[model samples]
Target chain A: MTDLLPRSGGPDPASAPGPVRRPFRDLSAEGRGRAGGRWRRGRVPGSLLSRVERRERRWSAGPAPAAPASRSLLAALLLAAATVTTLDLSTDHGPVEAARGVVADVVGPLESGTAALVRPFTAIGDFFTSRSALRAQVAELQAENDALTDQLATADVDTRRLATYDALAAEADDLDRAVVAARVVGWGAAQTFTDTVTIDAGTEDGVSADDTVIAGDGLVGRVLTADSSTSTVVLITDADSTVGARVGSSGTLGFLTGRGEVSDGATLDLELVDSTEVPDRGETVLTWGSQDGAPYLSGIRIGRVTKVYSSLRDSSVRVEVEPSVDMTSLDVVGVIVPKGTDSARGLITGSSGSSDTSGSDG
Target chain B: MSPVRTLVTGAVVLAALLLQVVVAPHVAWHGVVPDLVLLVVVAVALARGPQPAMVLGFCAGLLVDLAPPAEHVAGRWAFALVVVGYLAGRLRPDVAPTALSTVATVAGCSFVGASLVALSGLLLGDPAGVGTGELMLAVLASVVWDVALTPLVLPPLLALLRRLEPGPA
Candidate 1:
C-alpha cells in the first residue's frame, strides 16, 4: 500500500495525506482570494478529509476486500433464495420408472439384496481371518447351520457375519427407504464399460445432479449430470472418483480419491490428503459431511482404507481402498439427495465452525 | 421448408439439452463424467442426417459450457462438437457402436482435450500428475453411458428424422 508514496514529500502523508489536506496547504496558489475562499468551505472539507482518510486506512489494510463482503453477501442471499426456491420445487416423487423416484423404490430392494448377497461371501472370505474370535464365530455358525437346512442356514450366516454386515444392512435399508430411484433406461451407446451408469432420473425427479448415489454398503459416486427424467451415476470404484472421507472410528479426516480399476483381486489405491488419524487396515471410510462440500450425503460409507503409506512432502498418509459395492455387477442403486441447503453451521455449530479462512481479517 | 418440422426438431434438441443439464448429471463417473454434449450430437446426426446435426452439435456444446459454470469461449466447444457431429453423421444408424468403440472415441477425444488442458502446467515446466489410470477409467465410463443410453435417444430421434424426410417407407 505504501508503494504509492513519493520520493520526497513536504509533509508526512501517513499522518495526514495530501489528498485530504492538499487544498488547505495549496492556499498559496491564489494568495488572498484562495485563502479567503478556503476559509468559507474549511469545515466541510475537513470533515470530508477525515471520512476519506478512514476509508483509505481500511482499503490499504486489504486487497479487493469490498468486493468479497458485498459479493459474498449477495451470494449468500442468492444462495438462500435458491435454496428456498428449491424447497418449493419438490419432486412429485411418483412411482413411475420414467423419473428418479423409482430410484427411491429400487434403493431398498437393491441394498437389502446386496447386503444379503454379499454378507455371507465377505464373511466366509473373512472366516480364515487371523482372528480366533472370527474363527470361533464361523464355527458357531457352522454348528448352528448343521442342524438347519442349507438354504435356511445361509440366512443365518448373513446374520452371523459380524457387525460390518449389520452396519451394511442397516445402512442399506436406510438407503433404500431414504432415496430416489431410477431405471437403467438409457446407456450411452458407446461408454457402457464405465463406473458411470445413466438412469431415467433427473432434476424433475427431485434428483439434482451432484447428489451422492449409494447402495446397501455405502458411497458409490455422485450425480455429475442430470436431465428432466434421467441422470448418470458414477461409481466410487472409478479411478477418478474422489470424496472427502474420515476414519469412522478415528475421526481422522482426509479426501479419499479412487486410484484405479481393480484387476484380478488386486487392490485399488485410495490416496489420502490427510492423516490426522492413522486409519487401520479395517477402519471404515465415511464421507466427512455436506458442510465440507461433500458431493454425497454425510455418513455414506465409501470403503475401507488399506495399504497406508506416508508421503515425504506432506504429513498425510496415502492408502488403498476398496469400495463397499461390487462395481462390476451393479443392477440397481439409490440417490441420496442432500436434504436442505440452509446449513445449520451458523445456527448449530456456533461461531467456532464458521471461522473464515484468513485470520488477517480484523 | 416446413416450420412445423423445424419447430419439432428444435423442441427435441432443447429437451435433450435441458435433460442433459438436469437429468444426466446424477449418473456421471466422478471426474470422468459422461458426455451428454456428445450424446446429443450423435443422436441428432443419426436422426437428421449431417448438416443440421453439425449446427445442433455446436449449440449443445455451447449449452454444456454454459452449464453451472459458464465458459468464456463457448465458441471453442462449437469447434469440437462440429467435428463430433460430422463424424457421427458418417456412421450408420443401423449398426450399434460397441462399448469399446465409444470408449475409444471418448478416450481419444478426452486425451486430446486433457493434453490441451495440461498445457497450463507444461509452459511452466510443471507437468501435472496426469492420472493416466483415472482418465482411462473416465473414458471407460463415458463408453458405458454412451452405449447404454444411445438406443433410448436414437430410436426416437431416428424415427422423427424419417417422418421429416420426404421419402416413401
Candidate 2:
C-alpha cells in the first residue's frame, strides 16, 4: 500500500532531483559530459547555445513593448473620437454638422437613386391599395370647396372680424414667417437613434439650425443639424426632445418632454411649471416659445392632455399628451424662417387687401 | 502591405458601407437594422491584425456617423468600433475556430460593441442615448442579428482577404 502510494514526501522534490540541477550555470560542460551526451543530439557551438539562452530569458521576462507609432496612432484616434462626440453634443451647430453635410451631399444622391429604383414597386403596391382612398379624398375635397364657395357670399358683414382673425392666425404662424418647403428624404438612421428625419432642403435654401419645422397639421420638430443641401431634424417625439408648452383655455405654462415610444403609443409628458395649474384631460397644448422662438415657435400645436398625475413625493403634476402629428408617417414638411422688420408692413398690406376685396365682392 | 491588397481591403470596406447606408433602412425591422459594417470589421480584424483593424474600424464608424440620417453624436460609433476591432484582432487565427466558437465571437463582439456605444453615450451625457431598459433590448437584438449574419459574412470575407493579401494565400 505504501509503495502504491508512491513514496510520499520521501525527499523534498526540490532536493530529491536525480541529477544536480545548476540552472544558472553554463551548460557547455554538461553538454560534453558522458551522461549529458545522451541528451545532446549534437555538439552545439557555445555561442549558439548562449544566444538561445539569452533569447529565452528575454521572452520570459515579460510583454514586448509596443511600437511608439502604434501607441501614438491609438491615442490620436481615441482623442479624435472623444473630441468629435463632445463637439456634436455640446454645440447647436458646428464643424461636426459641416462634416456631416459633406458626407450627406455624397450619400443623399445615392439614397435618392435607390429610392427612385424602388419607387416603381412601391407605386404598384400603393396603386392597388389606394385607388378607392384617393377617389374618396378627391370627393371630400370637392364637397369642402363647394361649401367654402357658398360661405364666401355672406362674408361682407364679418369681413373686418374675419380679417382680424386671419391676421392673428398668420401672426401665430411664427409671426408670418418666410417659410421654405422641404421634403422628408429619409427617416432617422438605425432605429436605436430614433425620432429624427432628414430633409432635402438645407442651409443653401435659407434653412438654418434651430429653425422650426412643421407639417400641415402642426409642429414636427426643429432642425437639429444643417448642411449645404440637407439637414437633420430631431422630431418632437425623440427621447432627448423637450418643448416649453402652454395648456388650453387657461394657457397654463408647462414643459412637454418626449417619452419615446411605448407599446400603447408614443406619448409626451407635460409637467406644469407651477404644478398647481394642473391641466385637465383633453386640453390642447401649444409651444410656449423660447426666447426669439429659435427651436420651438409660439402657438405651434404639440398635443392634447390625455391623463394627469400628481406625484405624492414631489408634488409635480405630469400629464401624458398624445402628439398631434403622426410621427410615423412624416413626409413633406416646411421650415419656418422669421421674416425681417418688414413683417408688420407685410401683415397690414395683406390683411387690408383681403378685407377690401371681400367688401367689394359683397 | 501590398498596394493591391490594400486596395482590395478598401474596396471591401466601401462596399459594406454603401450596402449599410443604402439597403439597411428598407430591410430594417422595428428600427433595428443588421449592422453589416460591424460584421465586416470584426471578420477583417480576426483575419488581419490589431493595427490595421483599429484604423479600419475608426474609418468605417466615422463614415457611418457623418453619412446622411446619422443624427446621433459623432464619434460614438467610432469609439465603439475601435474597441471591438481591437478585441476581435486579439484572437488571431493561428488555428481555425469551430462553429460554436465562431458564433460566440460574433455574439460576444456584437454585445460588447452595443454596450460600448450605450455606455460611452451615457458617459458623454448624450440625451439621445437609449434608456437602461431599452439599452438591454437593443444590445440583445444587435447580438441576435450579428450572430445570425456572421456565418454568411465572415467565411467569404476571410477567403477573399486571404486571396487579396500575398502572405496569407
Query: Which has the greatest TM-score?
Result: 2
Which candidate achieves the best lDDT against the true structure? 2
Top DockQ hit? 2
Residue A213 of model 1: what lDDT?
76
lDDT of 2: 0.66
Model 1 interface RMSD over true interface Cα atoms:
24.3
* Chain B only, TM-score of each candidate: 0.66, 0.89
lDDT of 2 by residue, B1-169 (tens): 5687778877777667666554554445545666778887777676566677788889888887787777777998888788777766665432133445556766778888888876775676565546787767767777887888877887777667655544311
Give the per-residue lDDT of model 1 (tens digit) for A1-362. Answer: 12232224334332444324444323221111121222222233577654543332221111110111123333343344334223323323322112233333333233233344444554563355437756776997797577556545555433443454466454434333225655443222112123445555566666666777776676667886565545666655544566777665545677765433433232445555555556777567777645423366556677776567776677757777677765533446666553322221211111223323321100
Task: Name the TM-score of candidate 1.
Answer: 0.40
Q: What is each candidate's DockQ, to 2 decimals?
A: 0.02, 0.21
| Model 1 alpha-carbon drift over 4 Å, by segment | A1-177, A184-212, A223-242, A248-251, A259-277, A292-298, A311-316, A337-362, B1-53, B59-78, B84-169
Model 1 misses residue A48 by how many Å? 99
Q: What is the lDDT of residue B158 in candidate 2?
A: 65
The lDDT for every candidate, in the order shown, is: 0.46, 0.66
- A33-66 in candidate 2: lDDT tens per residue? 2112222323345778756533332211111111
